[model samples]
Target: MNPFELEAAVKAAADGDASAFAQLIEAERTQMLRVAGYYVRNHIDAEDAVQEAICRAFTALPTLREPKYFRTWLTRIVINTSMSLLERSRKTIPTGGAEAEYLTASHKDTDGTLDLLQAVSALPPKVRRVILLKYMHDLRLKDIAELLELPLGTVKTYQNKGLNLLRTYYREEIEERRRAVEPIAADSAAWEGKDMESELSEMLHRSRERAKTLFENQSAVASAELKPFIEDVFRHGDQVRELLFIWTKPGTEIGISVTLSPDGDLIDYSVDMELYTEQEKCLHLPPEELFAIGERFVRDHYPDAPDQFSALEIEDRGDRVFFSCSQYASGMPLPRSGFWIDLHRSGFVTAFKYFGSKPEPVMPDHILTPEELLEEVAKDLSMKLYFMRLHESVHSQGDDRLHLVYMPQPYLINRPAVPESGESKKNAQAKDDYDPCAGANEPILEVLRRNEPGVPADPETLLESLGISEAEYEVLREVDMGSERGVVYRRREAVPAAEAVDSTDPYTLYRYMQARNEETVKVRFDRDSGRISSFIDFREETGILQLDDRACLEIALNLLHTADPFVFPHLRLNLEEEEDKETEQPSRQNAGFNFSVCKDSVPGFSHHVSVSVNRTTGRINHYMSADLGMEELEKLSLVPSLPLEEAKRRLIAALEPRLIWELDYSDDRSGDGHYMLRYKLVERESGLSVRMIEAHTGQIVTDNF
Candidate 1:
């Protein structure tokens, strides 16, 4: 079986073609058994492991991303199965017979060969496996590293350690054998001048040379033997126009490169038993002609190249033309995934390197309409106001103004409710009865009563006492609301009193009291700097009052209109029952509505804002906002390119179902040990992924792109 044929067989097997799968197993049975034998005690155990591996391979064939690597993939499965069996049985497998059959036949001194094999087998499993693969299987260090999924340097260490152990064991065994045949004095005299280390090294070197020679012979035979197989596999046969060379290395693909002469004649050809790089042949050709030649070369050699490869760049360095191309899907180029073909002036391909696997686009069976997708987005739509700083130039100085922007709400995935323990439930009930607003009302009333007859105070002294630096604060204006009189200062040098009060510090206890004609002690702090720049104290009493949820929501909506008209249309009330559970009580709770933007029904790409109104006074309690800069707002596409129905269709077509372990955020108890099935939406070309819809509900679960 050749590489191409093996890949075809793997594909066929993956598609449930039993005959092709059988052929694949038959071709690899010998190698699989040989590798498996190292880990088990006997032929029966080795055979069992190989059989189990074959079953597993057949079952997992569809998951194999690259069919060209069927051999390595199967070999790994065998190794794993064998290791598992070894661990389960907890028995050491002696290598006497297996070693004699595999390694000792090449050596003339059977005793010495057996001693070396014993030493190798005596080493730890990892080291022993490396030695056997390198020497017995005639695999290179690089091949061993890949086969074991270890780093090259780590494999070299194991090889050296194994060799040192073998040398020690061989020397001890040789000394014991010599002593049995001769007297101690005679044996010492006979071995006195001999360097055992040198002898051992020479012996090991000879064994390695034999293995190399055997590999070379095998390679020579494979070149001739595999020619017909390659021709048949490539579907060219004897009429092949280009010279084909099969490059093979231990634990790697038997890659074939086709070389064409300038005049389209068959050039020199040779098969390499290891990875080989050919010297560059300079070709004098125009950039356009070179690009055409490179494209043709790739098409002829790798018929498996992706369908859409855009020209990334064409570098003309006088001597050569390097044309780079990348794979793209839906106009988006895959990151670091493409081929770079370098050509010299002589029309020779200097290098052909591919960075990523070929793209496999899967069209979903059911296409969703844009409207359907929009509906899904609406379910998770959250509205939030973001405070953004807008800068304007007033003469030479820059004036920073705060603005509120409306955007889509982010992840609104339904979290599982946590089951509370008995003690926790009791504590939560107790907390529910604790009225935070009532407690806050008492302090404001006391401050109002004490300062009802507004006393005059120096603004600078007042700011200093409030832990604010004069350099960062400046008195902006003075206001008299009947009983209360106070000066308002800039929250920060950049922010105005009106903007700060309107945006972040809307529901301060003092501000609430001011509206009621109660004690007018008011203070506003810069949200970011923690500096108080606005203070007012009034002597009066404002009785407790409450507002309904409808009134609160109306106030919030009205505020949005005043903040930014552009943001009003995009905002939608998030009326989720579970989300509003905390504010359900009419008397104790301030009515508030969570608003989210459903502007464009794209999952994982939205913004949000929330507003809460005081239950008693119907005053705005909290207004959450985001700072979406002007540049970002300018780029906002109010209308989506695709309709909700169309987006849904594309999503359905591109959905990939898989079992994933996702954190159940809703789970109140620990919230850590839950996983479920999910269908993921992945862009094939770029590998950009998002978990848009759940498998069960077909609803958007995440807004992450």
Candidate 2:
């Protein structure tokens, strides 16, 4: 069938038309049977597998995300069905005359191809599947990984191992039979037909032309002084896309990226110091010298920049140091209006970012003192339990796990409450309830305790919750959602992208994926730590299931319990019915329940599991868990060393506000906005210059952004 006809048939099939599904399957029957034969070997079993796969596909047709990829999706289902059938029967009968027609249909009826197939069948099951998918189906390694639900690295390993075994088993005969088909070496004479150097030169020329064209389109706003710097940076860049120019060394990760505004103004410039590669290494220069270098750069590039921008603070990060300067007006630094230079130990200026076009505003004559500021900000200061995810560190031996700890927040000063209206109520509520702290902390593992690890959910139980029977639907596609530091485990329904899977629900990921292609349930966990980090159910309803809110909640709760029983007791349903009533936007049609983790009924941390249930089938179409593991929770420092009153006292004592000029962009119609004088909280420890306070020994742990 042609592409348009096939798509129409897929659409018709998705709408419960069995005839269209039959036509779709019939057109690809020969190819389907051949793929099935790779796993089952015998003709009878292959045909049975194909028939069973067709039945399953017909039943699950509506769940398909992309109609155009119908054939590829059907082939995947056949492969899975065949493997499942083989596993159940444990039969390894050699291929006979009955299967020769199906097996040799595309192999040109060659004995070498038959020999190769037999050799592959003799190999290990996983390796054999990899080889068949890579060569027979002509799929990329990544595609094979997604098809088999294995890691791309693991799939590549299996492919290489299978090829080595094949060479060892049939190297001599294959070489003699197909000498001309051998892979050509880099220096082979076969490449002499093409001018490689000229081709590369032409490609380079085209890339430059594209870059020039892009630059010219926005040349009206381009500053004359910025031309030299832009040319120097773009000269080393390999790619110029839109306003972003990126250049990375071929073999090394050392690179730099520059982003510009639509009007050709600089937005951001950063260096990717991948473990401080030789080219990007810093000289470890003194702070004084680094500060001088920053000032000199500003003096040369920005006229009067050295006079307008004053040094605020310096942060020493062992390998590199950051010298931050802010646009000063009336001897006070403006909040969120500053540029920081990253200088390496090698004395190299690794990064230079200019936050420019200083706003002219009337300076505030009077600023609130620490005593008066304490009274105003004291009400907003409070100690709350926080779930902080640690960063992967070698010195501290951190494993990037979540840890529950006490943290202090100047809520009013740091983040003022905003009025929510219309469709923003749900998003506003989510932000208020689950604003994660920015940056990771290096946890001292030796001082912290560890809890007994809980068992992960059984693959069978997870399937059962979705109304999928283990006996009836035996194909378990294991998806390797890559989590390097944790165990990766996934089991989901085998449905490809179908166009009819669109969703209008804001809470559902169907809308996030844009519903243009691919939809499937994916459960991913850290590979080494074996902790569940994410679980998303994107499968569309099959019209065979339906339930109410209680039933949906029960299903979600049951699944959460199966995943981690200990965490189950601490979870409470986060019903936002009242919040939804205030919004003028369309009410949510799907049933979604967010369960927040609480200790003794106090909701402090932002660890929750959100489940989206389809209103039509009552089956969970989306499930996301950002909760910490029970073992990680056991390591939490529940009790604070300082009393709440004492913590508040310290917070009050540390409170100080500086008067500065800030641009007001509440209703920014034009690019230029009027500036206003504002009072911003500053840290007294940094001489009332910086905005961050040093963490107390056992009081305020960290600031939540």
Candidate 3:
């Protein structure tokens, strides 16, 4: 929507027009939900938060000081609501009505994914929120910090600490499995009691029982450091019970570990594949069936599997074909194999390899995961399974590097209460000075026995309770409407401008800014030929003000300021999808805009289309080309024959960032050699139309016009 449409919508909503408000809501709901979902992992809960946030915004619209910031304001509400819901089930906002209204398809998917979400939901509020924002919602850390009103450093600290714990936990699990295998061969005499097949069966039974017991008695057996990861990791272990217990044929646990960047990149990860058996197990898979099962498993579970992970090497070693599946992805905590019809065996899984950036410099394991070492040193800090680690550049922080740990509250709505005796004493602690309602008639405190229970009643309530009829209340409310009557304006007349300026009146004095000299050039809109623009203007012939540009700007700003914020907010966004094996990052080309005002009239949204000094940029950019109007060629340049590119070149000037230059020939040069300059080029590229911008003036220096 353009500024005028936005202004109109805001004005209508401010006047209680709910339909106008809907457009604003529709435009922002997706962004609100995305941010809200991160806070409230529970789909239904997030939906509830958005609804309530919108509803609250509707009523609060009247109080907004800046409507242009509606987007950010609503986001703040959504973020706060998510945190409130996560930390305490008791909602921060009354959203009961909104929850039912905003339900969508995603809200229903929450049920089946509960098994997977177990680990995620177990995280503390702060940690879990960070993870949700980073992965689930794919928000940048900088935005997360701004939305949550937190310092950037603090958010980064939480992210690093959280992911480190998760990585260490998975790594430790692998180490334990390795130790259980004990690389040294088992004693031959240990199988003295029975034949190899029968002995293997007995060992399988024991191993299954042990694994089941660990799964069942984990609440007690798991160490505190790994307990949170364990609970969520296996929270829905029962949901996948058959797969975990019944289809049991494990060598080593298949686990995955993910490393995330502050910018939402899946920077690194490892998938570990292990082959081991309990104290004993049967290797009786006829070579034919085993290979079939392994191949089927890889194909079914990893349909999006990496291409050519490893060359399959099959060698017929007389007794059996050694099928070697090599160099699979390591550090994946999630198992790779799922049930495949061809595999016939649900438990059969094959090793896979990892892709993406090679890990940074061959730092020692401890360097990569210093938080683990810290845990080893400080036994008490165990909350570290929900964050991504990103190194801080020295320019950002003075530290060598910082970790972002997601620290969410593990539970919600459990708070300590005050004692009964202290409750009575609360009234005694009430503030003393400036009680406008002090001993006022009607004792109106009873109406708000909730918000301000022990406090004095408000004056409005006091008057209403004093038998002031509805008719009488309006007069009282309007008594001091125009301005505070306690001062000279008490006579109920418009004060003259002289007194308005001299007086520290209830309203701020108006200061008219000097009007800039009239400047004009032809401007054109390719599509919306009839839309009015928001700009300052002056009549060329009369040399008189055609319109007060400042007043026009103030009107738009005021409408934004007064309009319901939940319905509209200022929003600026930059988002791009990640590069994966199948796809690469695409370069974005930015095309510059050109405009010169025309005498021709244009249609508008609600008002007249006038070509003025408006400088608003276009909405989303689309690739296209257009012929420059003859007038555009002239207004921007008196050289009629000169092409657009050459004309632009003469208009541009170059400059460097943060650099100061002192010309020896300058008569007005200061003693200090300093004048900072910044640069930008106007013409943009969209992979085809190449152009260079004049660094200093941000004008189109050159382009393939």
Q: Please name the candidate that would achieve the greatest TM-score relative to the true structure.
A: 2
Q: Which structure among the candidates has the greatest lDDT?
A: 2
Model 2: how far is 182 from its true place, Å?
A: 52
Which of the two candidates, 1 or 3, achieves a greater TM-score against the reference? 1
Q: Estimated TM-score per prediction? A: 0.23, 0.46, 0.19
Please report, in order, the local distance difference test score of every candidate based on alpha carbons. 0.42, 0.48, 0.30
Clashes of each: 53, 19, 62
Ranking by lDDT: 2, 1, 3
* 1 against 2, candidate with superior lDDT: 2
**Model 3 lDDT, full chain set:** 0.30
Residue 148 alpha-carbon offset, candidate 1, angstroms: 50
What does candidate 2's lDDT look like per residue over 444-480, in tens digits? 1111123233566665566567555545443334433
Q: Could you give me the TM-score of model 1 versus the true structure?
A: 0.23
lDDT (10s digit) by residue, model 3, range 377-421: 122111111111111211111121112221211111011121213
Could you tell me how far off, in angstroms, the CA of residue 116 lies in candidate 1 after the best superposition?
76
What's the alpha carbon RMSD for model 1?
29.4
- Stretches > 4 Å off in candidate 1: 1-543, 569-584, 596-605, 617-619, 626-649, 662-681, 691-705
